[model samples]
Target: MDKIKIDIMYLFGASGHGKVIAEIAETCGIVIDGFIDCDDNKKSVLGYPVFKELPSTTESLVVAIGDNGIRKKIVDNNIDAKYPIIIHKMSTVSKRTLLGAGTVIMAGATINVDVNIGQQCIINTNASVDHDCLIEDYVHLSPNVALAGNVTIGEGTHVGIGVCIIQGIRIGKWCTIGAGAVIIRDIPDGCTVVGNPGKIIRKMND
Candidate 1:
């Protein structure tokens, strides 16, 4: 039988998040082909060649930008390509958990049983999602963010670094939970929340 050849995967963005994903891919024994970025001035990122555009015949790619909106835009632009779910070797993901395409679980992240993480999401370093949590598409859970059991995070939401949400709380779509914020109640859609108890500082229309 002839052996099947595997094409290398490329990481998009070529920034800090891209570098981290490169390391994680390397740890998983997956060779990174290179990086594709809009910035044409730079040559390489983390020793990998940076390309202005995705190479011809490119198939697999992962968006590694930290910003949720930028990542969403990049994924939307390249909707035809294959987006693989990359989980760091150091992270703990429950067998019952469901992770969608283009989701990256960074080092030291812990996802308990029955967690559902949506497409193009970022479970950043040292983050923890307790049992039965529902995290929607394009959500970014920053470093050290913790979510209790049965919590639901809506699509395109950005949970900031070191923030903590209480059990059974529901956070709506396109919301921004500020860093170090303590969420004690449900948050509405398209709002910017900050401080303890996670007050709504600004709405999307403002």
Candidate 2:
């Protein structure tokens, strides 16, 4: 969807993450119609009404949940909803970068030239994605995470807060890089990595 055409939008998931997205939307001067959540007990969020079901409207919708798996599930189920790329006003995204639908770039994030971020991905606050980075669908780069040039993060992978990845590293799908990890080597799929050199402690399904 065209970002410029977004006048009013709705956010799915009425939680803390949703609140952050609301602030980003507001900062971008986009009017939020309301929030949609599965929780019946949630009546409102950030002064906006919350509905149990998505409203039938032409406005765009943003999946505001922070969990990669849950966000992917919601996007898959809501195939008809228009998903737009939500970039915070304070983010520094190069015009040469390509951001996929349903992706959210938080404040203070820096995405450099030729970066391609996939659908439903989260480039969290203050995260720095250097040039030529490829971030696949449903991936989350937590706050203050730093990726050097030519890094590739696979689908559904989560890089924890303050993690630093060296240049030309390829991290595989569904892997978890723990907080403060310094990745100096390639990571295989489905692994849980931690420590300074990013050792794989265990497989995700272990």
Each prediction's RMSD over C-alphas, in Å, is 2.6, 2.5
TM-score of 2: 0.94
Residue pairs with clashing backbones, model 2: none
**Model 1 agreement with the true structure over 1-206: per-residue lDDT tens digits:** 23222376789988888999988887787777889998978799888999999998788999989888888988888889999988998999999999999999999999999999999999999999999999999999999999999999999999999999999999999999999999999999999999997899999899
TM-score (all chains, Cα) for each model:
0.96, 0.94
**For residues 1-206, could you state the per-residue lDDT of candidate 2 as single tens digits?**
33344745789889999999999988887778999988988888889999888877746889999889989988898888789888998999999999999999999999999999999999999999999999999999999999999999999999999999999999999999999999999999999999998899998668
- Model 1 poorest 10 in a row by lDDT: 1-10
Q: Which ranges in model 1 have alpha carbons more than 4 Å from their true place?
A: 1-6
